[model samples]
Target: MPNKPSLTTPPANDPSLDNLGHPAIPFPSSANPPVQTEPVVEKTAEIMQPASEKLTALRAQAGSKLRSETDQAIRKLGAHSEKLYVSQAKLLDNCHSQLRKQPMIFLGLAVATAVAVSVLLHRQMR
Candidate 1:
């Protein structure tokens, strides 16, 4: 017959496990350990400072470019509006000249258009 192992005995080789099959908690040996954080923090700050300055400069350059583009667009709109206004004024002048030269023809056409519209409306009502 084979013998059974005793439950009360602990294994000798492994120090990480306790007798109850749970992991052992580690205790710190040194009284005061050094933090050693200042050099890393200073290096990070030194790297980030140049990056931040470049970012600020890039933002300013983009803003100036956008402002110039906006100004150019506004100027183009103003020029187009002026051209439209001048063409409209010329059209109005030509219409006025034609009307002055031949008033009776325009009056007859107007009467004919009114008669045609009224006849269409009367037909629709029926």
Candidate 2:
């Protein structure tokens, strides 16, 4: 059996490969000065703090707006319901006044309605 060439090793004298036969990527060595991380962390915190505050303020503003709108809607509904109640009371008062003015007429009408309903029920049973 013949030996197969490995896929992991690059070909010799390849232009893309460095003298060490590794890809030509620059890596940090002891020669370069160490990168300072504290400034980056402070800058990130400085950038995020205002954004967090703005988000919290916006949330509170939206909640306040929603509460105010809900209260306004409830007040409007309550006012409409109050109007409906007043109108219903007025209608009942008018009906009572009419019945008082003509008790005998309403009584006759009631008896006729009762007789008509009984006749309908009796016919349905048959």
In the predicted model 2, the residue pairs found to clash are none
Which of the numbered candidates is closest to the native, going by highest TM-score? 1
- Number of the top-ranking candidate, with lDDT as the measure: 2
Error of 2 at 45 (Å): 4.7
In model 1, pairs of residues that clash are: none
Clashes of each: 0, 0
How do all models score by TM-score? 0.62, 0.59
> Candidate 1: where is the Cα deviation over 4 Å?
1-43
Candidate 1 per-residue lDDT, tens place, 1-126, comes to 899888875665566542334346443326535557999999999999999999999999999999999999999999999999999999999999999999999999999999999999999999
Q: What does candidate 1 score on TM?
A: 0.62
- Give candidate 2's error at residue 93 in angstroms: 1.3
lDDT of 2: 0.88
Candidate 2 C-alpha error for residue 35, in Å = 12
Reference-based lDDT, each prediction: 0.86, 0.88
